[model samples]
Target: MAANPWFSWTYVVENADTLWEHTVQHAVLTVEAVAIATVIAVPLGILVSRIRWLAGIVIGTAAVLYTVPSLALFAILAPLLGIGRTPVLIGLVAYALLVILRNTVAGLDAVDPAVLDAARGLGYGPGRVLVHVSLPNALPSVVAGLRLATVSTVAMVTVGVVVGYGGLGQLMFQGFRNNFYRAEIMAATLACVLLAVVLDVAIWAGGRALTPWRERRRA
Candidate 1:
């Protein structure tokens, strides 16, 4: 009876449905949180670039939020939100905001002042300059930030188990609580690693595709 405590086909075979559900939930949580963060952060980043004074305040707030414990966030939100995925979603988004925001700011700031002047000389207004020049130049940095935030969020989703909506985290945590069931824990852990790798790769490829000129310049 070649039994491995860490993993077993029997466990996977029996829990296939549950595992699939958990994996989907994990992906959903990651996508929703990151997508929401990107939508909020990018525009805010653009605004901040234009309004220098707002940069410190907004980034500082997001930084503070990022430092808060996930469990504490769940606890704080549980009363008003009631429970489950909502709190988790908010927490993940908060966690992701700083990374994306910082990257956006950095990307924009890194753009050449000469380029902005050139756009202005060409009779481009601020909006047109931003849309045509600054953003495209800064896109690679923004893409890198997205990749980092995404990978971080994938790992952070496990913390949502406290609110009963952690996706693969639920399974991973449960296995430990249930007398350290190795196979269950291993499966969930591996699934999370796989999810993170897949998302990171996809984002990287997409970024590369979008920023092909960057490659040409480097070469």
Candidate 2:
């Protein structure tokens, strides 16, 4: 009788070393893309939130960019960037902006008017108030956005297989090419899932640590 390929540990054991390398590559790609997106999107979000009229245009543009098909984007980008990690990184960054930007805008907008007024009343300059009060208060929302972007990026990185930059996704692709090698496919899928779960938990814990005041307020 044939054993269940999905549950087979053979591929995992056979390819353990390569699997680890691919996992690391996947993690690095995901982290770099998200970090870049956050840096660019957070500031743009703040600017749009501040200049109300610009919000529509900036966000709308991001939305349109986000709506572009991932493969199509890759096809377009591969020509300009020339394969490897650059196109994948650029695509992931583009995919992430909408979530991060909207979250940043929402977070900043959600900051209490009373809190801002109090900071100003205390002689805090606009810049100081934003840094000390507005940003801190809005951090929960921002972190929430980061969590979403992180998970989405993890899933999207698999699409990077289209451009020879799949990371763990490469395992699955190899399995597909090798006649339904379910063990490889399953292992790769499991690794990606586990990575996403771990990242989500870490982000959640970091958010809690950063927003200790929320716990105090509740208490």
Candidate 3:
């Protein structure tokens, strides 16, 4: 039987097992990284917002981390993490800080000063103002950060294959290695892209659900 071209469904279907495995691995690692990034970044963001001068330093440092090539980052960390999900998760969390940190800063800064003043006028302390006033106002931007982080995390998981993490990139690389050539490569690439898109849409919907105030403004 003649082998189909890369674009053909039959050609891709043949590699379905490998492709599915990689997809699952990629999704799992992404979720883990995003969860950790949110936990770390949100609190750091809040702290930085109060510090004025320090916000620039902290955010600039995170932005520098974002610019590092994922492959290179993984390569450097691979020795320490020793070829597994650990290196991949570390790199993903680093990448996420740029988006999450920026959005958090922007969201917190966007809160109405008048509203904050009113909260303080009502005898609310710094803690109450932050919890009830600032956080709710910033939820939209925080959600935006999550959306960006999720998509970036999904795309970057391909680099995990370098560390033997076996994400979808593993299927793509495997196909290339075995001379299965076109079909497996195309299928794996398409699957990764589809996974990112689905994650993006899901996060966006969740954001809308969680921040109805933003929706009301649009309406």
Candidate 4:
């Protein structure tokens, strides 16, 4: 009798414990990278938008950094940071910068001129107008950028397996080594995809909640 060569429920059940751990590790790495990138990129994006000439330089630099292949970037970073999570995290953050920064700039720039004029006419200072008027209007674009960054980060985290730090990637690698353990490979792949979808949806929901006025207008 031939044995099952495809995905196996038995293997998944047996390995449930380790799989859960790897999933958590993957989520943590992705979330932390995106969070750090957002913190740095949002303020830089706002400053660049106001400065005009600096906009091209800043966005271009980030685009170049993002253009570097994931493996090549990891290889360059590995020696400096050593084999571990640090290199992976830094690489993910670098990749995320362009998307988040671009969206932030677009969002801020899209704020209606009349809205700002009204705020200023009502005695609102520049700082207050930026916080109260600009930031709120820009939330949609910022959130869209965040959604892209989070999904991209999740996919990129799999590449960290080369450095022995990829959470789900490690499992997939093991499956490959074990003579094409289809079950293991499929399980890990599905988990990563699911994580990305969940993150994207969560960001979308949060954005809608924060900007309830848009929802109200739709009704």
Candidate 5:
């Protein structure tokens, strides 16, 4: 393949199936982590926002977890979880919590007080006002958080290779271990970047769908 050329079409042709497998694994892991984080973070965010006192405690803990070194967190979980996707998923979710939680809380808090009061005046209960009014207004920020978390998760999926489940990371590390095979490494790296971009765009579209009124306002 032209003496290990950086762009070897032959290498890609020969390893297409393996490459596709790794890419699929990478995408799936990213999706799973982000989805789980969203489910946990969103509700926790709502609770903390309502409680006021718990906001710092919960978000601060998530922020601390975010600062824990990714490799170190993965290693710590490995002993307990026994070397697999479980530890990797847990670590990724830990990292995602801060961003998503912060965005959710901020979005909820940013909902106009006057609008909430008006909803109350119209006989809406607190729960109804929050669900029907506050959450919809906060949709953009929450989705922004999700987008950030998803892209970051895609990049972090590579870290899972240490625990034996990093999708494209497997290919990248394989190339590195095999004397820096340019084609394999480049292919994996490019795939990771492209996955992140596609996910960000997808989330942006989702956010738009959730707030079509915002689009109509712009129009």
Candidate 6:
């Protein structure tokens, strides 16, 4: 007889399809932003790494971008990029620059100078040294930066829903509007949290796997 009630949990199930669709859409938004952010940031990062004068200016600009409020950025972009994925993605990509750029710089800086000298001594050209020695060593930091950019993108995508692209934030807003306190809202929050956790853990694991020297040193 208790098969149905006001809070029987069916309310959550009812909205599952819409919620899933939004989650998938949000993931797509996140992945695309990360891809674009990585490409732009990494090249600039490498260039600035080689030129000390540009590093402060470029990275400082990225830090400034990170400080701007997401909502404000969205509002500014909305008129130009219009209300859709384009503006939202643009904002997320901007927000990602600090993490990506900083990490790239750090990785490049952390490369062993002695190793670089040895490579040069061995007749390795600049191109060969960068390709075989520098990049591989800098990879951990690059991945760290990519991971940070990805997580930031995921979180920011929900905020972009304010521009009408619609995501988990939309679901939560709808639940509040309807005054139903639907389980769907809880589920959406859980999904977002899960996504964050998965990214964090995966990055952590991958970072460790890539840097076995660190593990051996600790051992």
Clashes of each: 0, 0, 0, 0, 0, 0
RMSD of each: 1.5, 1.1, 1.9, 1.3, 1.1, 3.2
Those runs of model 4 whose alpha carbons end farther than 4 Å from true positions after fitting are: 1-4
Where is the poorest 10-residue window by lDDT in model 1?
A: 1-10
Model 5 lDDT per residue over 83-151, tens place: 878999999999998999999999999999999999999999989998999999998999999999999
Tens digits of per-residue lDDT, candidate 3, 67-171, equal: 999889999999887988888889999999889988998999999999999999999999999999999899889988998899878888887888988488887
TM-score, candidate 4, is 0.97
What is candidate 4's local distance difference test score?
Answer: 0.93
- Candidate 4 lDDT tens digits, 157-185: 99999887999999999989988778888
Candidate 3 wrong stretches, greater than 4 Å? 1-4
List the global CA lDDT of all models.
0.92, 0.92, 0.87, 0.93, 0.92, 0.82
Stretches of candidate 5 exceeding 4 Å from the true structure: none
For residue 181, give model 5's deviation from the true position in Å: 0.7
**What TM-score would each prediction reach against the true structure?**
0.95, 0.97, 0.92, 0.97, 0.97, 0.87
Better of 2 and 3 by TM-score: 2
Could you tell me the lDDT of residue 154 within candidate 5?
95
Model 1: clashing residue pairs?
none
lDDT of 2 by residue, 1-219 (tens): 155377567767878899899999999999999999999999998899889999989999999999999999999999999888999999999999999999999999988898899999999998998889988998999999999999999999999999899899999898889887788888999999999999989999999999999999999
State residue 13's C-alpha deviation in candidate 3, in Å: 3.4
- Candidate 6 stretches with Cα past 4 Å from truth are 1-9, 180-182, 204-219
* Model 6: per-residue Cα lDDT over 1-219, one tens digit each: 243323435655776688679888877787788889889998998899888999889998999999999999999999998998889988988999889889988999999999999999999998899888887789889998888788777778888878987577777677667664556567767777777677778877987898788778889
